[model samples]
Target chain A: MDMQPIVRVRKLNAWFGAAHAVKNVSLEVEPHSVTAIIGPSGCGKSTFIRCLNRLHEEVPDARAHGEVFLGDTNIYGEGIDPVVIRRKIGMVFQKPNPFPAASVFDNVAAGLKLAGIRKKALLMERVERSLRHAALWDEVKAKLGSPGMSLSGGQLQRLCIARALAVEPSVLLMDEPTSALDPIATKKIEELIVNLRKEVTIIIVTHNMQQAARISDRTAFLLLGELIEFGATSEIFTVPKEKQTEAYITGKFG
Target chain B: MITFSEIAAQGYTKRKFKNRLMCLLFFVAALVALTPLFSIMGYVFIKGVGSINWSFLTQLPAPVGESGGGMANALVGTCVLIVLASIIGMTSGLATGIYLSEYGRGKLATIIRFSADMLSSVPSIVIGLFVYILIVRPMQSFSALAGGVALGVIMIPTIARSAEELLKLVPASVREAGLALGLPRWKVTIWIVLKGSLSGIITGVMLAIARVAGETAPLLFTALGNRFWSWNLTQPIGSLPVQIFTYSISPFEEWHRQAWAGALVLVLLVFSINLGARFVFRPQISRD
Candidate 1:
């Protein structure tokens, strides 16, 4: 692990009213590296990532108490704007949700447009770059004027990826990005995620264990809102330290 | 025992007969529902279309003993009242909807939601009487402004609730997606949430407008029915419903015919509005 990780978490805790959703856990994600968080349902993988960018606060009874540092700045610090933090750490959701009101081109351009980027040529270039980055440009380039909803599920997911990347965020949080997609689409997205690591740091939460081994430089195993294991992918997969981790990896129980 | 094929064939025949009977019954029910509307439209067209000339449309109402006058003032008055009322109605209704759906929570939201439901269910005449007390008595004179205020007030709760419901139909995921991109809350609500529900919201607006347009009870006490052409908002103005009411009640036969003509025009106006609303908002449904 690098001494100065791009994202560092310390004693992170979250609750949905009385239900503790994310337990006290700490982790660090190095820059331009893929860190996969793998877990079963209700394991707080989504909640943990959402906390990274303050998206978890949108829930009615959801609350987080933790110190999350983006570089040297404590993201959860006083006077730190969550909106600014969100801009810096773009998030893709479990479900592909592109704006139905916006066209394919407009959907990618939406983030930039919201950030007050008015230069038409710059928007065009960035939109193109982002789409290319998500590996969706060639398929959707001809019909960019069509509504984003008109695209296939995979294409829409890729469109969402492009939308997130358009803002040029330093970190990207994806919560089960390919869970809703078919195997072929999932493969495409997996490839895109691998490629995207060269530009932006990525933290992907996926249920597929093979996916973790395939893409992640390092992997964290979360269970019942607690971090059970965090280590290099090869070491964790071949030689497990925790019995629970081994059981989960071997499909003894989820 | 009968063979299996024979039994199956007999059952098929019975089912086909039942299906045809059900289809015929439904057709009859539809005809029964539509008969009154068609007859009323047919009667009005036969009687009123003759009365609806350029002069009848563009001229003032004929006096009690006079002829050759038009509902020109009434037409313009109705338009003005509707235009003013819609502006007042839709703006507040939209705002209320946004609050109710997005910001309204706790006891206040409950009170507001309850208030909206109760207000919409209030009888239009009761609303008229209430408006009379609120505006007409205070103003000391019947004004077009007061009439518009009544209609506008009547529309607010219905529009508010429907728009709120439509806005709620917008998936939370879409809203989350936009906010995740760092868009402001207002932008997420207005540009994304409201825009996504635009067609449905417009449908609500249209339904509310249609509801308020044909109402005579509210306008009876407020606008108070003008006899002459008047544009000033402070003065009483003629409206189609009120004109139809007055003309239909009088002993004068020609006035009765003119009233029928006015009813025809009003029906067409509202019907077309509803029809146009469907067409305008259809693309929204298809997109969804």
Candidate 2:
């Protein structure tokens, strides 16, 4: 509690037309730590994470009102570009989406290359480091020249993680990164998340209770677009203060 | 329990007969659809092959009563007109399509899309007349530049519509992934989404090129069919389709033979273009 939090969200509200998706969510995430958001489907877990990087508003009818502070700067302040904010706070989606037209190596270098970084030496160095950090360097090092979409399903998800990490963001948001993976792939990604916490702060959204318990230092339970409970992962799993949190964690209801 | 014999008695034979009859109908319909394609190709080859000699391809057209000549001037003119049209058509068409699919979501887009659809259905002859009034009258002369602009107008609507459809096929997640990487929306639309659908767009362009290559009506008013060898864009130019049209209508027997040869060459040019497009822009190795 003594160390200053890296990310602080206050009075966050999101809507898709008239449907309010994320309602007044407030939380603080410690630097270089993992925070998991567990909830049932349509409970705003994904929307809450998206709002941190202003990605929630990308949808056609979507809008948000909130203050999200990233290292003392409110990202929603006037004249602040969402493009710049996104570079500082990276995101990984539920499905593994690697650029279909680019090679594995190029996919990892897309963010920098598109931002006008053209030196081959710089791109190669950053791509290698990101791949290593995502723990996919050994599996894909030989096939770096092949199309990114040619990778196996599990490997593609890790490749996506590497793509996100290549930009060197301070905070990483993962929206159901393991939902589309098989059991073994899911386990590997969970391990990767634990390892990644040492380099960057992480906020992960998952419906899997066991995953939140196994990898998170802190947990937030969201239900019907509201924050139901927030606490240390061990206590929330063992002795949740709220009855709804207990019912959800114990599998009585989603 | 009902036995297998009980099931068979329940109109099984009648249902099987109906299925066979429908399959036969579909097969016959397919054959009917293919008849015109094969017949035209076969007829063109049979009548046109004897007229095709090396000299017929290299030498300029001889005077009307003469026997020895070629369509070399027409070939080069066709090439010039195509190059001009491609520049104009591809640039504007691709831009319009990108705008329509990516940023066009209001009344203006609807009006543009509707206008494009109407323009595509307009007859090529009417397009020629419109260009005749717009350019030919103002310039007071038929020139390759005017002809090229006419063909280019015919190409725009086709390319724009196809580009829109092909770009729309790119999955939304792919675009979202680009945005999440901190790339601006325009960069994501152009470098990522547009680049991915490039092969499909090229295929569409090639088809439009082939269609315009065989067009005679638009060039009739603008190019006006030069008999002599010429390369100047401001002067009258000879094109394959126009040359074919002119020679086919003449009373001379020699010109008829040359007309058949020109038709064959034009058909072959279009066929090879289509074949080349497939070879050059084959889709990248994509799993999904």
Candidate 3:
């Protein structure tokens, strides 16, 4: 039997006021694999990813017309709460946006707390596990009481990941996770991403082609709000089917 | 070559003269603004320092010409009235500001903002008159409660406008971060937006208090004045501004001297509160 796809996007279109940001995007993400969307800036890579969890619903005059399925259930289906969908599909932003006011422990347990997990021992246990899963446990274990912002940039990004993972989502979405970090921190996060793929389906949007090639199993190239090509990471880099993909990988043009 | 050098020197002298003229204009403007500040301080010190006795601060106002009386009643009453006003003004103002910045958008927020601006510009005497008709007549007496409510009414628009401006200064990215976590909008505002802008909000509240504390017209008809100590909110209370106004207009030498002392005390109190607010709300050094 074929393994089930964790997320499937079909004919997705997103518009920001008068601007059509994403146009006719369709792709399927397999379970337990990293699918990195690669494109130049303003190519709707981020918008496409944001649609996976309906984060764009907050913007005024922002409307998305498409079908996004999360494990055979249409996420945008009627009566499906965006909050509940977000709880199941977590995201990490480009910047390490840990709640600046909250402590490290509270940051990791934020989702659980929102879900009304009030028991101290349960919160502590879940926070520890999530931190361990994000590979941030050893560094932040002793300083869990300290502010989340007190961590190094790379550590803070990982803490954000830990915070997202604490809700135990099936798919983890990362938007340029290590783009803000130094080389060493980027390498650490790349390794963590490789390890995380074993437990959850991972979708990442990144501008760094080399990082996408290194960490992703499949790569999707998007240009001007359209998905130009999708295939195995090696093939997309070495033998792209589309001219736009070749131009992008060889730095000929955005 | 000598003639060329002479021309260059003349050019330099003309430029220097123009620069000096500009500098002199700036200096005059600065000095003109500062003169009243210096004069007030000087006048207060010269007139009131001799009356700054322990008894003057500790004892109630005595008979019209007596030297033993202090502004004790006025001082305590002013503190109570300002505290009550601050509490009412700051809470309601903050809530309204949050509503405007977070939830309000089109016509309703615009109307509220316009009304608040108009309210801030309304004359303080008119505010006093309004309070006199609305609150004092119903209660059938001039009281500290009426005074505080009048001052709070004046302060509300100031505090709300400042708070709204401060809240707007908070970057949208901060709010986005909280919302991205699937937290509700209200939770994000209270737990994140409010915490991030706490210092700016406190500064706005302090500035509003300073503005209301020195107001003389609003309290003229509301609190009126008391000759002795009065704790009843329903009875007349002796705030420093009203006491200064009444005593300064009186012909007695002792009353005039006491007014000067009370004015000095009020100025000092306002100055210290402003300084304390600045110290408390100073930005923290970021580790990054």
Please name the candidate that would achieve the greatest lDDT relative to the true structure. Answer: 2
TM-scores for all candidates: the values are 0.96, 0.96, 0.88
Q: Estimate, for each residue in B109-190, the C-alpha lDDT of model 2 and write its tens digit.
A: 9999999999999999899889889989998999998899899999999999999998988888889889999999999998
Q: Write down the TM-score of model 3's second chain.
A: 0.92
Off-target runs (Cα >4 Å) in candidate 2 are B1-21, B280-288
Model 2 interface CAPRI class: medium
Q: Distance (Å) between predicted and true CA of B108, model 3?
A: 2.9
Q: Judged by DockQ relative to the true structure, which candidate is superior, 2 or 3?
A: 2
Candidate 3 off by > 4 Å: A100-106, A109-121, A135-152, B1-32, B284-288
Native interface contacts retained, candidate 2: 0.63
Clashes of each: 0, 0, 0
Question: Which 10 residues in a row give candidate 3 chain B its minimum summed lDDT?
Answer: B279-288
What C-alpha lDDT do the candidate models reach, one value each?
Answer: 0.91, 0.92, 0.88
The first chain of model 3 has a TM-score of 0.98
Candidate 1 structure quality by residue, lDDT tens digits, B1-288: 899999999999999999999999999999999999899889888988877888888889877799779898888889999988899899999999999999888999999999999999999999889889998999899999999999999989989999899888778888888888888888889878888778778888988888888999999999999989898998999999999999999999889889988988898889988997887676532333
Candidate 1 lDDT by residue in tens digits, A45-164: 999999999989998999999999999999999999888888899999888888766789999998888778999999999999999999999999999998888888899899999999
Q: Which residue pairs show backbone clashes in model 2?
A: none
